[model samples]
Target: MMIDFMTLRADFPLLQQKNRGKPLVYLDSGATNQKPQSVIDAMNQYYISDNANIHRGVYELSERATYQYEKVRHDIKEFINAAHTEEIIFTAGTTAGINLVAQSYGRSKLKVLDEIIVSAMEHHSNIVPWQLLAEQVGANLRVVPITDNGEMDLEAYEKLFTARTKIVAIAHASNALGTINPLKQMIQIAHAHNVPVLVDGAQAFPHMPVDVQDLDCDFYTFSSHKAYGPTGVGVLYGKQKLLEKMPPYQGGGDMIESVTFARTTYSKLPFKFEAGTPNISGVIGFGAAIRYLQQVGMQNIAVHEAELLAYATQQLVTIPGLKIIGTAAEKVGVISFVLDGVHPHDIGTILDDHGIAVRAGHHCAMPVMERFNVPATVRASFGLYNTHADIDALVSGLKDVLRLFK
Candidate 1:
């Protein structure tokens, strides 16, 4: 089916606005996606009518609110193709989800001199939690190196496994480099070594469909904001067996069967992990966003972004003294590039004057920057609502940057 790109673009209210007297050319979707009208309405509708605390009150309003909230959990389970709804645990965001696994699973499983495997392209969310876990448990980290084209070295990745390898924490796709790692193969390899794997799916969720069952990853996580949903919400999918073995990450109301002066019993699989009042409105809005993506179709979105990535790369390389970073064979619509004799910050500033938004910094993946031996690069990431015209504006802006610097 041919998608009406312009019609879909109109759904995003932010895209209709102007910036600095020029039409907004948003290319920084890797940071966060602009919400569509439907998602906004979903949240507003909850606030307007069904405003009540969930799961404790027997009142009609509270029941309605609680139903809306729990319904999203099932929606997310279907969205990611998990085996059971009990495996899906909502957290603050991807960072919180990863840290929850690290504290609850990693701390309990790992021992002294144990190793956690990660790649060089990991975002700090994936890196820091493991680092803290290792430090706390007298463990070490084994990093799988990346090639010049930004693909993970599979041979080295296989070699990283040892008897003491506790867990493998990796990214489904690199947020800074746009490299789609061989996640299935990596998971298989980790499983062969009897080590569980956790995938940080923040970048992959926006561009592609993720099946946690197909991947067989022990834990998978991503933030809602990156997938055009509201902030303060994220998902962590764990196997029922693993979740049952691990203890709760936090203690509070709703996560317990009963509390007393003596020992207290915890709630069931998912609720045991999710303590305290949750992000009620954000979770409801996330359900709306998931419905929107399903309506559009994940394959359709992937093909559209591939076209943008190809065209943007073709146009960008034609520019003089410009070099693109992260040329992995498999990538989403993310392009990080550097120009001769110009700092990334200067490029970003010039583009901003033209009302073009792009990320220009280490992008919270300092190891990726260090691996490439560059301070930073200007990154223009794409989304489903982006157009060829946005890429054209970015190319024109870059030409202006070169002219001013030279």
Candidate 2:
């Protein structure tokens, strides 16, 4: 089913705003998506009516907040088709989830002779954590090289594993390149060597359906903000048996079963990893965003975004000196390009003047920038609310930028 871009665009309040008397064209959704009215209202309603701490309180308001918070976990579990809600651990965002696994699972499981496998397309979030883990544990970090087209070399990936390989951490999609990686095949290759895999699904889950069970990944992490939910809440899905074996990431109140001066006991599966007071209103709002996606449907969003991606790519390539950085066979709605002489930051400034918002920088993936041998690229990433007309605005805006520079 084709999603009505006009109707979906109306749901986002920020999309109605104007910049310099020009209507806004938001294309920075790969960083953070604009929220629907339903999500904003759901979060506001939680603060207005049910504002309280959860888990420890006995009051009705606290109980209601707790239930709503927990239901979001279940909603995500069902959304991703995970085996159980207990597998979902909420953190600040995807970076935090990766850090949790690195600190807890990596520290415990890795030995001096072990190696961790990652790809060149990894976000700094995925790379830095493992680097820290490797440095601390006296382990090696092996990077699987990418093809010129930005696709990871699967043959190279399979060859990177050996008897000492401990785990594989790779992104389900490149945030900068928009490549939808062959994760099922990658996971199978990793499993053949008895190595677990952690999929950084921050970019993948927002654009398409993610079934952890189907992928058979040991751990999957995504942030709520990228999926049109509130910031500060991320989902980390892990196999129950593995989470049970890994130690706690942080020490705090809610993550405890019992504590004394002499000895402290930890809580159960999900709680053990979740320390401190979580983002309550944010979790409820995250649930609202998931419900909103449920209404629009993931497959429909995927189809709509794919069409926009093709149209935008086709149009952007017509410019004289514009070069696209990633040209993989499969990608989502991201276009990273550089003009002949105009700097990406300059391009971004000119586009913003015309009310077209695009991202320009390393985009937190410096290694990807280094991989492409470019300092920076102007990136325009799409969302459900974006339309073909929005792409037209961007193309027209780029022409204006080019003329100004010329």
Candidate 3:
């Protein structure tokens, strides 16, 4: 089915607003997506009608609230093609999820001199948790370096595993570069060496369809905000067997099945990981976001975004002194570039004057900037709602930047 991109753009209320007296051209979806009206209505409906805590109350309202919450969990299981609903663990966001695995599973299994493997392209969320874990347990971190084009070196990645390698944490797609890593092949290589892999899917989740069962990854995480849902909520999908063995990352509230002074028995698979009050409205709204994406279809989004990326790249590179970064073979709707004699921050400020919103920084992946020998790059990332006209505006705004700096 061909999606009407303009019709879908109207679904996002924020996109309709003017910025600096011009139409808002949003290109920073790699940071956070603009929520659709359905997501906003879903959250509002929860607060207006069903505003009770889940799992503890036995009354009618509480049961209704619990049903709305758990229904999203089930929807997420189907959305990602996970084997079981129990495998889905809710968290604050992708950062919290990585820290949970690093503390719960990494602390339990890793020993002194053990090794953790990660790529240089990882977000700080994926890198720092292991760094702290290694510092605590005397484990060492081995890095898989990227090539000049910002793609991971598969040969170097496979060679990093050895007798002491316990876990491999990497990104499914680079937020800074928009390069989609070969996750299935990477997972198979790690499994062959008796190592488990964790995938940071924050960037990939919004752009493509992911199947945890197909990839056979041990753990996968992504944020709801990046997928046109509410903020302050995300999901961590773990294998049932692995999660069953790992201890809870935090303790309190509904995570306990039974607790006494003498002995405390924790709850089952997912609940064991989720503690305290959650972002109830966010999860419910994420369900609506998932439904919206489903109606539009992921493959259709992919095709549309691919065209936008190509058009943006083709237009951006034609400008004199503008060099596109991360020219990988496979990429999503992200283009990072640098201009001669101009700072990225300056470029971003000038573009914003024309109502274009692009990110200007290392994008939470400083190592990527270091690898490219730049302090930062101007990144224009696309979403399903974006169009070729948005790219045209971006190019025009960039030309304005060049004229000002010249």
Candidate 4:
């Protein structure tokens, strides 16, 4: 079925606005996606009609709100093929999710002389938490190297595992370079040595289908804001046994079943991890965002973005002195590049003059820049609503940028 790009674009009110006297060309989806009208309306509906705290109220509005909130959890479980809804724990965002695992699971399992394995392309969120965990537990952190093309070195990854290895955390896709890692093989290798794998899926969730069960990963994390949903909400999926074993990340209200000065018992699977009041409006709106993706179809979105990537790559490479970064054999629609003699910040500023929105800098993955020996690169990322015309305008904007700099 053909994706009606025009119809999809209509759902986003921000996309309708003009920028700098030119039509808006949004290519910064890797950072955060623009929210659609459905997501906006859903949040408004919650506040307008269903505003109530969940899990402890018997009132009508509270019941309705609770039901809607839990419904999103179920939907996400099915979306990712998680084993059960109990496994889906809602948090503020991906950073919170990873930190929860790093602190709780790390404190519980890691010990002196233990090791944590991670890849070189990780965003700061994925890297810093483990670094802290290693410091706290007196464990060593091992990094898996990447090939020059930005693909993970599977051979090198296998060699990193040792008797001391406790866990493996990695990104499903590179936020800066758009390189999708081979998660299946990586997980298999980790499991051979009895290590569980955790995937940082912030960049991969919106652009592709994710099945935690199929990947056999013990834990997976992603943010709703990256997928056209509201900010301040995200999901963490962990296998039931693993989640049951790990202690509560925080001590607070809803997470506790009974509280006393002497002893406090925690609630069941999900609520055990979800402490205090949640972003009710955000979760309901995220449900709407997921429904939007379902209606549009993820398969169709992937095809559309792949075509856009190929066309844009062909056009952008024609510009002399422009070098594309992370040319992995398999990648998502993101294109990161360096134009000779122009700083990435300047490229971003110039593109904005042409009404093109792109991300510049290390993209929270300084190790990636260090590996490539570049301070930063200008990144043009795609979303389901992005069109071929957007790509054209981006290439045209780059030409304009070149004229000014070169």
Worst 10 residues of 3 by lDDT: 269-278
Candidate 2 clashing pairs? Answer: none
Let me know the TM-score candidate 2 reaches against the reference structure: 0.99
lDDT of each: 0.95, 0.94, 0.94, 0.93
lDDT of 3 at 60: 92
Candidate 4 residue runs with Cα over 4 Å from true position: none
Q: Give Cα distance to truth, residue 40, candidate 4, Å.
A: 0.5
> lDDT tens string, model 1, 1-406?
7787768999999998888888999999999989999999999999999989998999999999999999999999998999999999999899999999999999899999999999999999999999999999999999999999999999999998999999999999998999999999999999999999999999998789889999999999999999999999999999999999998999998899999989999999899998999999999999999999999989899999999999999999999999999999999989999999999999999999999999999999999999999999999999999999999999999999988988
RMSD of each: 0.7, 0.9, 0.7, 0.8
What local lDDT does model 4 show for residue 277?
A: 95
* Candidate 1, run of 10 with poorest lDDT: 1-10
The lDDT, on a scale of 0 to 1, for candidate 3 is 0.94
For candidate 2, the per-residue lDDT at 373 reads 89
Which 10-residue span in candidate 2 carries the lowest summed lDDT? 1-10
Candidate 4 structure, TM-score to reference = 0.99
Please, what are the lDDT tens digits per residue for candidate 2 over residues 1-406?
Answer: 5557678888999899998779999999999999999999999999999988999889998999898999999999999999988999998899999999999999999989689999999999999999999999999999999999999999999999999999999999999999999999999999989999999999999899888999999999999999999999999999999999999999998999999999999999899998899999888999999999999999999999999999999999999899999999999999999999999999999999999899999999998899888999999999999998999999999999989999
